[model samples]
Target: MVFQARCEYGMRMTSAPDPFHIQEELKYLRLHITNFLSYQSAVLDLADLVALVGPNATGKSNAVAAIKLLREIPIHGLPIAIARRGGFDQLRHRSSGRPYNPALRLDFQFGDNPVSFYELKLRGMEGKRYEVKQERGVLHFKGDKYAFTNNAGTLGFTEMEGGHRSRVSGDRKIPVPAGQSAVSFPATFGLFIVARVLQLMQTVEINPALVGELQEPSSTREFEPDGSNTASVFEELTSETRAELVDELSAIVPGIQRIELRRLADKVTLAFVQELSEGKRREFLAKQMSDGTLRAFSILLSMLQESRPALLVIEEPEIAIHLGALRTLVDIMRQQSETTQVLITTHSADIIDTIDIDALRVVWSEDGASRIAPVAEHTREPVRQGLITPGQLLRSDSLDPASA
Candidate 1:
């Protein structure tokens, strides 16, 4: 009866909130990787807005892939996440004389409390597959503590009233499937902290190519990572937010007057209304829009959503974007970072120039492995002193991590 009341008013409810609104109290601090892609071992310190800058093959994309992997684990479970990346064999680094297993650790903080962490280690098995070698996590939030550990598929969980692990009735031993993570298992005991951690791990990876595809109608209002459901998502925004989005898009594209959602049969798509002249108007379907227009529109829509993800990762968003619009794009990202962490991988000098030196992290190759760190003090000093832009330093190869 309650659900029917909401349905009559066009409200949608689910087992969990759609388009999870990341709590502002939670913030990611660091990402540690081992034997993943070009990284033999690396730690990236995260800021609200991180601009991952480097030459090609420096492992910028690898870092982004790692975060995406973490995001998938909670939703798709461990085995599928591994399979989606072509199995563990392809993901493990091929460095000579080093361990073949790949591991990842993410550190996060809830407000000013002690840091919380989740770690996962995988071991290669026969048939070019992998199994969970070990997994553990400790989370302290709102006066409740939850901790879980899984060693070789043996799972243990504890819930307590304080930060220290207290042996409560929830403490129990079980065997998780070799291919699963206890934290990702829906029926795990003491799942409050694990669920909160995974909720904050929610991430969206925007692909302009996917965002440009034609969309079909759906009842869901949640924005997807690849933005395939953009038209429907945009259609659900409140009128005030839609107005703001249209105004922002017009500023970026110079002629866009409004955005209209069109539906035909089961198909749904966006149409851009442009005022060609004082009395002349033109309409273009999303298919007819320029790549730059589509890309910018997708980004703005994500930023304007009522509920935002914990992390927004965009790879080479500069592609197909006008140089003049780069500042506008960066500005929106900066504003969005106040509510959601933004991570971008790019080689665009304009993007580097638009962001601050503190937000810059340089990725480079050292000893045939990728290493990442904050920009060198030398390069940072010049940029901070206003002697030259970070973009100039990037073009001259002065932002190399080796010099740090």
Candidate 2:
């Protein structure tokens, strides 16, 4: 008997037949923003691992917030999501006493096929209401393209294939209500790819304190953004997976023997077993563990989950962790990026040191708006000459366009 192995983004192939095949899919491509938060207009070409770096209040978190809001659109609908964030006025950027409409454009690709793009523009209307000024969806594949545009009270769709053009005419006009996305309409066909892509994007804002709290045991495999169900999720992992996590945790922090999820009466909590001297072991409850330890555990669990999202946005992962553990954490993030795209915001020089310059996006403020640039392009000479690490360039303020 022979076992056939399948290759995945992060898994290692062992004892498998024909392991050279590559499964490449475009999960996320590019994000363009205009008049959104502090960005008048900015575009980010997302990679597997992206590190956003800059000083405080430079809109690092704002970028994450934009993605988060976009993630909410498919679920809660555009109007409700905008309303939850204090309406369109607050979501849009106001500069120089001029009212600016907010716009977002996303590009997604599906497994070596041509790219699909979604563009949405929102404007504040009379009586504190907001309207979707323009919405468009385009899909290009194999020299053929399908596109639809909804603007100025009219909706139209076009299909171009083999140099022939056809319009969706004669009662084919889809009626997309104001403040709604055309992709969300049930009548729309061939746009499920865009919807599926949006569904896979996730933003995680972990709170270490939440990890310490008692949680009800559940069979959930997906970890929440706040890490509220970390203990329950840990309980769901198989023994082999749990052991792997323990090994990773021990590697990052010495003296950790094992992790146990114990259910007490009606509550479940995590316990960390530390190997004591003289061949003894001591157990510490989640509350007794250090902040850094709990935070590290949350991050490790998120990365090691069997079922994960396509894109994971983590904000400020360097908080409360020991500097010595930054390398291990960075390594875990990089490894996880092989399977899932990771976007991280950090102010730690140590975290920046472990990242490649190409993975670094220098975020800064210019003229009351936030801007982002690739670190290599922003700091050309020093990076090209190998004279400075990204960490060093950050500390020396060489990545700041305003300073230059």
| Tens digit per residue, CA lDDT, model 1, 1-404 | 00010111112113255322226677888999999988999999888899889889989988887887876776667777777877788889887755478999988877876788888999988878788899988876655665678899887766666645545634446677767876566344333344445544434556656665666776766677677888988988999999999988887898898898988667878888998889799998887888788888888887777556666777787988988898998988898898788888899999999999989888988888899888877667878889999999888877756344
- The best candidate by TM-score is 1
Residue pairs in candidate 2 whose N, alpha carbon or C atoms collide under 3 angstroms: none
Q: Write the per-residue lDDT of candidate 2 for residues 1-404, one digit (tens) a residue.
A: 11111122122112121121111365688889899988998887798999988999988988887887776666566777787677788889988967688999888776666788888898878766778899888866444566778784356766556356644332356566667765554233334334445646777777878889888776656788888989987887789989988888887788898899888889999999999776888999997888888888888888777556678888888998888787998898898899888999998888988888778888888899999877655475666678877778778777654233
lDDT at 36 for candidate 2?
A: 92
**lDDT per model vs. reference:** 0.76, 0.74
The weakest ten consecutive residues by lDDT in model 2 span: 1-10
* RMSD to the hidden true structure, all candidates: 5.3, 7.7
